[model samples]
Target: MHTAAAVADFHTYPLISALTHLERLPDQLRVQWADGRVSPFHYQWLRDNCPCPQCVYNVTREQVLEIVDVDEDLVALDAHIEQGLLCVRWHGGHTSRFDPGWLRAHAYDDESRAERLAAKPKSQLWDRAFEWPVFDYAALMEDPAALLQWLLALRDSGLTHVRGVPTEPGSLALIAKRISFIRESNFGVLFNVQSKADADSNAYTAFNLPLHSDLPTRELQPGLQFLHCLVNDADGGESIFVDGFAIANALRDEDPEAFRALCEIAVEFRNKDRHSDYRRLAPIIALDALGEVAEIRMANFLRGPFETSVAQMPLLYRAYRRFIAMTRDERFRLVKRLNPGELWCFDNRRTLHARNAFDPASGARHFQGCYIDRDELLSRILVLQR
Candidate 1:
């Protein structure tokens, strides 16, 4: 029977390993080890990492490692008492353990080595390199399964290329049918046209569009943007792209309050250039009413000025400028030479796509592109991944 003095002294001890086996126990706590030795530890270490609430994974999947197996392991042995304890500690850490007998039974075993590996870091939701069927230009777009697989891969990758596609008028239509939504932009396609017929007009800087989400000032900015390059050759025409979601997440992490300011303040964007065009006003850092982040808006052309109270305007503008810096940073920007028959699609709500002027003198380039709703891509991916 235990005494009050022993119980009090137990708390004073550091729960050292050597003393574990010394604790009196029933006949059930014995086991052998890989090195042919035996040992027995008390319940202390056994309860430490038992996949309990105090452990990880919310104590789920307890059966992944079983404590029951240890019950049959306890036994008597002729092994030395101290070495026996060491053996029990080691074996107990595995699936089972031995008190003393099992150690002598396995006395001829050799030593074993074991260690745990570190966990993996998280990946960007849009980084799809690990998925199946890498983006290759050789694959044909005709096969239904192959076509569907290709489109889904495009969605997962947040980028894709269509090869051998016709470069004529209706090519964009066929391409649009493969995907559900469409984002029609100023030009039928994002072209770096440099043909002699376009001598005076170096492909559009008649424009220097601001870095902004396509239409995020709206409730739903086009989720996807498709750029099908039908031509490529130029001195000044290279497309600039930035992954807006990555930038927004970075800002959110770097300074949550600054991010909060962006999420809270409403900014106005207006451009009635042609065709029933209208403007929208919303937070530069758009979030659904649920507080789930939906999109970002930072535009020189569209967004005009800060509308918040005088006090909040300065803070909001500060975050706005920081966001622009992040988006333009080389770390976040992806510059690519879009060539013919190459179609790239991205989450426009989460990516800001742009282009620089090129001399149309040398030659011409043409690209036909469009947009589709973002959720369509997500819904399709969920269905497929499921």
Candidate 2:
């Protein structure tokens, strides 16, 4: 039983003072905070989340007590506030202690959950006129602070330009290793972006590649892409970029039905060759749990035939065409000529990339490319901040 003396001593425990009341019910416990917010926790949940050394390993941080070992109908026989912690003695002779701060931090009430979800960082949408964020490659490679700022710019704007990189082979891989290990695919660790005699994909040709995301056929697409221009003395191989998220949001605002269809219908993406065959079925626009656009997968060259029902085929095509048109719109597309010694990096999941047709006989246009997962870039940013 809780006593008045224990409650009076809460002033020393600032966390305990936040709790206005605690009600021990038959199967669960309800805590009313000083702010008038009520949070409920089941007995089993509290037991599972117990921070005591007996229940959790102190060094490994792993849970020692299995949920099956606890009684399914266990109840708190007695509960009290002791030294800023909520102490509970269970019916089976097991005791648990919970810090009020932990409880408040891990609150799962409707209001708390909503607030947490709303606090997530949102990407800043951009159009063709948006100025590209540029950083010195030498400074970024030498200084940790410059590297973090460049990475954050990529995270927020979905694109960044790094100039003054040494124009040489394998430079892209070295730059990529600064953030994390390169994400290797069938193309190899460091792929060449030059015209080939018999190209496996359109990206290897000198033809004007349509604006699209890379490797959509794979189940797990690469998150970040690095393209280092070693030689771009060509006539007309200008680079093009479009923000897929911006176009996706525009579709959602202008034609909600089209947006819904794109999000609901799953299309097939396939990459088949003599040596390898990869395939995946995914929606063009993937929404997160909060119904916000999380990723955009669009690759016309790799997109296979629609496998949806005949009735839905027309709707899917309409939405697909609308999205493709939006990507090509001059207002959304940014065209720039990447010069030698310049490195371009962008979010592969958010930015659609393309190239203009160049005359192979005009001059040489060579680039080294590599990929890194999105999580790696984000992790580096967090560690740098610390």
Candidate 3:
């Protein structure tokens, strides 16, 4: 076996060369990250009520390993790539050879990694808004802490909302000041209400619509979406939301090929309404380029027909089908309603949002919203000290 000194060479290649996603593992359970880093995670749960008899006593065995009983760093060691194999040196100095082929085959391909772990979607419920402080347009114009808190919540609920903002139609422009860059859309806040003249809805499209993202085909899509509700009728017209990141993640786990295909092909998006003229080309599935699910672009209506090289068409079609199936899957969709005076910000890059047609039946439905460049938003969050 090569000495540990020899293994350090593996770090020279891109981290993607060293790391791998073990199909279907749970917890912060990255078996091997692109950086040749390894983290302990057996399943998806973050808190470890580990039921292993060694960690937890079998009721019959009656000997619980108390918190103080276990060595915290379970097994710490560095790894080296030797003879095409990535070997792990256990805390005790013992070593194990990991099948190098298995690691290489899936390197930089998290879909393969997800399959190894067998992760799937469970019924996740998110209805009301988040408990964190919801700020007014003026406060948000100054402080973005509330938005940050809601964003971090994605670790669990995969979605969040900011409620009770005193909406001033002009407030959206100030709100845009916080972001690093803006993705100006043709329709910053276009409206299509429930009217007796409406076509699709047998009943004037009155009910709130299902959850979906704003754009699905832009090669670079808006990373954040903020809507400041300017007016709310005495009755309906609440905003609805679903967590797209979680849904895409669940799909990645259930089918690797489908996941891979989605990443490889770009879906066309077009908006040719009389008032709007816009078009985009992007993948239905997006990644951080580091092999993680970063965003999901799923807009059935916005997507234009596939136009690709003949050789790429069949493969592209296969991927298109996969995306459609997953988007329609109810298990992957979580729903929520947003009330007026409520300012909701969704990770335009990661979350999908929608709203139903409000009933003019009782009152009017109006939302005054604007765009904030994602770069601006992130810069506000990550201003560096150095």
Candidate 4:
């Protein structure tokens, strides 16, 4: 039988191993599991996570008790294992019960923590030779498994294609909604990609666009980008994609100094027009807590003049030029001409995209684009997984 604490959380943590014994200490409780794993839970942590209806709201299943409300020196007067649960009575009249399943799942033991870290999904880097991951739009729209697979490809590989899409002007919205809500920017919810006489950005004109991430001028760049081809009757304008992570990793292996320079120096990215002017200063590459390459921000057109110390100017320029040259390298580029009724969805931050100049006079070309944050994609994936 599951305790009230186990049923309170959104996730159902299965009993992986049963609790064998519990020992109470001055400040924490030591637990021993059937799997021979020892975990220590501090008295404060247990009290703060109490899932009783009095401590946590029953409807939302959210914790209502704040740790500050309880005494900082709060000690458990007694703690014992009863009915496969860890029950703790506080020095005061308060009490907290932890389910065996939940406790094991959240165990902070070194071995358990390492196991969890190892099981996390990691990016599968790829280059020009990557077998393009393509999915049928109809399947993704109707089947949960197919949708999950497509999202996983975008998450791991950073690039994906969807075929058999309707060529309607606004059909991109339908497929975008399959993931989650669209992220709105200064360019609007759904932006059109076509040549215009009065253009605000280089993307609005028929020009050879350099490989770059979209909207680096913003504080938080969009995670996923959807560009759906409605009409591709024009000549040229073939899409070019390069795995930014792959290029970054190659730089790290080949020239550690350049990689370090890019990661350390902050540059300015600006987007200005008659109506709006946005700018942001950040390093070209960002690392996560574990010192792994987590993001890449590159937009040659949107970049302002490089501003750095006179001593480091040469190194910064050398690193910047090297990174741009790598993007142009044939070994890293994957060039493809998207046809009507097809859409390209990719990780905007990790996949640098470009376009060859097309002749607008030859014929007409039109595409619709939108953005979605990473949180939405991960949240949808988790819900679909459940």
Find the candidate with the highest lDDT and give its number.
Answer: 4
lDDT of 3 at 77: 53
Model 1 TM-score (2 dp): 0.58
Candidate 3 residue 227 Cα shift, in angstroms, is 1.5
- For residues 266-286, what per-residue lDDT tens digits would candidate 4 score against the true structure? 999999999999999999999
> How many backbone collisions does model 2 have?
0
Tell me the tens digit of each residue's lDDT in model 1 across 1-386: 11212221111222112222233354433344444334443343342324322232432423343446445444423223453333223333432222222223222223211111112112134321223233434343344556557656555445455556666745766666555645455443333333444333223342434556565445567777766777766565566766566677778899787888888887787655445465687777777664555676756666676678878878987888888887777776666666776666666766677777665556666666567886776665545443
Q: Rate the local accuracy (lDDT) of all candidates.
A: 0.54, 0.86, 0.53, 0.92
lDDT (Cα, 0-100) at 38 in candidate 2: 90
Q: What is candidate 3's lDDT per residue for 138-222, written digit by digit as tens?
A: 4545555654544344323444455545665555555555554445666534322334453432222555555556655455666
- Decide which is better by lDDT, 2 or 4: 4
Best by TM-score: 4
- Rank order (by lDDT, best first): 4, 2, 1, 3
lDDT: worst 10-residue window of model 4: 1-10
* Backbone Cα, N, C clashes tallied per candidate: 34, 0, 29, 0
Q: After the best TM-score superposition of candidate 4, give how far the Cα of residue 276 lies from its true spot, in angstroms.
A: 0.5
Shift in Å, residue 351, candidate 2? 1.1
User: Each candidate's TM vs. the true structure?
Assistant: 0.58, 0.88, 0.55, 0.96
Candidate 1 Cα errors over 4 Å, as ranges: 1-140, 148-157, 181-210, 288-292, 382-386
Candidate 1 residue-wise lDDT at 364? 64
